[model samples]
Target chain A: SQKIEQNSEALNIQEGKTATLTCNYTNYSPAYLQWYRQDPGRGPVFLLLIRENEKEKRKERLKVTFDTTLKQSLFHITASQPADSATYLCALDVRYGQNFVFGPGTRLSVLP
Target chain B: EAGVTQFPSHSVIEKGQTVTLRCDPISGHDNLYWYRRVMGKEIKFLLHFVKESKQDESGMPNNRFLAERTGGTYSTLKVQPAELEDSGVYFCASSQDTGSTDGYTFGSGTRLTVV
Candidate 1:
C-alpha cells in the first residue's frame, strides 16, 4: 500500500525558534510535492510547492526541500510565530495537473 | 476576486437520509475539485471536474455518492442514503488550470454529521 507519513502528530516549540517538519512516503514516485496550512474549522491554504528536479523552495520565512531519492520532504519555518501554529500538511502530486494525495499532517504549536 | 464558496456550513442528518452539498468556485475557474476529511484521517480527493465534464472521479468511495457540474458553473455532491461513516468535512476547491503553480483555492467546507 502507498503511504505518506509526517514526522510527528504534534510539535511544540518556542516563538522565534525554527521549526522543522518532515514528510515521508513509500511505494510512489511523485513529480512534485506541496505543503499546505490548515487552521481549525477551516480548509487548507496552499503554501509552498517543490518539484522533483528542484532541491529547495523558499517563501519568506518558510522553506521546503525535496529528496526524491529518500521519498521525503522537509518543511521549515524560520523565526516561527504564534500565528504559525496550525496543522501543516504535505501532499504528493503524481500528475502535474491533477489531484493530490495528502499526508496525515503535523500539528505545530509555536508557544509564546 | 471572490474565493470559492461552499454552502450549508454544517449539516446534521440521520443515516439513510439524503444530503446535497453545493460549491461555487471562483469566477473563471474552470477546474473544480472535491475533497473530504473523515474523523482522524487525512484529507482525500473525491473527484475533479473540468467544465461540465467529470475529469476524474476514481477516488469516489461508492456509487451512492454522485457529483455533477452542470453547464460548467457550480458543482453539487449528493449522497443518497448517507451512512454513519459519512460524517466528516467536505471541501471544495478550484484552480484556473492545472499544477501547483496555479494554487488551488479551497472553500471553508461543510461539516456533515450523520447521526
Candidate 2:
C-alpha cells in the first residue's frame, strides 16, 4: 500500500536553534512536494514547494529539500521562535494537479 | 484579495440529519477542491471542480455526499443521512492554476460533529 509518513511525535527545540522535520513515502513517485504550516483553529498556509528536479527550496528562515530517490523530504526552520511553533505538513501532488495527499504532520514547539 | 472562506466554522448535528457546508474561493480562481480529515488520519481529498464542472470526484466516499459549484463561484457540499463516522474537518481550497507548483489557498475548514 502507498503511504506518506511524517514524525507523528512533537518535536521540541531550543529557541534560535534549527528545527528539522522529516517526511517519507513509499511506493509512489511524485512530481513535486509542498510544505504547510497549520495553527489551531486556522487553515494550513503554504510555506514552500520543491520540485522533483530541485534539490532544495528556501525562503527566509525556511528550507525544504526533496530527494526522490529516497522518497523523502526534509523541512527545516532556522532560528526557530515561539511564533514558529505549529503543526507542519508535507503534501504530495498526486495525479499531478487533480488530487493531493498529506502526511499526518509533525508538531514542533520552540522552547524559551 | 480575500482568501478562501468556509461557513459555518463548526457544525454539530445528529445522525441521519442533513448538513450543508459552503466554500467561497478566492476571486478568479476557477479550480476548487474539497478535503476532509477524520480523527487521527491524514487529510483526504473529496472532489474537485473547475468552473462549475466536476473535474474529479474519485474521492467521494458514497452516494450520500453531493457537491455542487454554482455559477463557477461558490461551492457547497451536502451530506444527507449523516453517519457517526462523518465527524471530521472539511476543508476548501482553490487555485488559479493546477496545484502542481504553487500551492492552493485553503479555507479555515468547518469542523463537523455527528452524535
Candidate 3:
C-alpha cells in the first residue's frame, strides 16, 4: 500500500519569515506531486505541481522541490504573511490512475 | 473564469436519509473529480469523471454512494440511507484536459453532518 505523510502538527512562524513544509511518501512511485492550500471551511486551492524529473519549481514567492531518491518534497513560502496561514496539503498521482492520494496536511500559522 | 461551484454549503441529515450534493465544474473543463475529508482524517479521492463517463471510482467506500455526471457538465453525488460515518466535507474539482500539467480548480465544498 502507498502512504503519504505530512508533519501532522501545526507550524507557527512570524510574519515575513520563510516557512517550509515537508511531504514524504512510501511504497509507490508517482509521476507527479502537487501542493494545495486550504483554509478553514473551504476547499483546497492548487499551489504548485512538480514532476519526478524536476528538482525545483517556483511561482512568485512559492517554491517546491522534489527529490525522487528520498521520496520527499519540500514546499517553501518566502516572506509569509498572515493571509498565508492555512493548512497545506500534498497529493501524489497514482501511476496510470486518474485518482490522487493526499496526505493529512500540515497547518501553518503566520503571526505578526 | 468562475471556479467550480457546489450546492448546499452545509446539510444536516439523520441516518437512513438520502442526501444529494451537486457540483458544477468550470466551463470547458473536461475532467472532474470528487473527494472527501472525514473528521480527523486526510482528504481522500472518491471518484473521477471524464465528461459524462466515470473514469475511475476505485475510491468509493461502498455501494451506498453513487455519483453521476450527466451531459458532461454538472455532477451529483448521492448517499442513500446515509449513516453517521458519512459526516464529512465533500469537494469537487476540475481541470482542463490539456495533457497532465494543468492543476485542478476546486469548489468551496459541501459539509455534510449526519446525526
lDDT of 1 by residue, A27-61 (tens): 98998899999999999999998999999999999
Q: Chain A TM-score for each candidate, in the given order? A: 0.98, 0.97, 0.95
RMSD of 2: 0.9
Candidate 3 lDDT by residue in tens digits, A1-112: 7789986569999999999999999996988999999998989998999998899999999999999999999999999999999999999986433888899899999999
Worst 10 residues of 2 chain B by lDDT: B95-104
lDDT by residue (B3-112, candidate 2, tens digit) is 99999999999999999999999999999999999998988999999999999999999999999998999999999989999999999999999864668899999999
Name the weakest run of 10 consecutive residues (lDDT summed) in model 1 chain B. Answer: B96-105
- After TM-score superposition, the amount by which residue A50's alpha carbon in candidate 2 deviates from its true location, in angstroms, is 0.7
Candidate order by DockQ, decreasing, is 2, 1, 3
Lowest summed lDDT window (length 10), candidate 3 chain B: B95-104
lDDT of each: 0.94, 0.93, 0.91
Q: What is the TM-score of chain A in candidate 1?
A: 0.98
Docking class of 3: medium
Q: What TM-score does chain B get in every candidate?
A: 0.98, 0.98, 0.97
For candidate 2, write residues A2-112 as lDDT tens digits.
Answer: 999996668999999999999999987988899999998888899998888999999999999999999999999999999999999999987677888999999999999
Clashes of each: 0, 0, 0
- Cα misplacement distance, residue A3 of candidate 2 (Å): 0.8
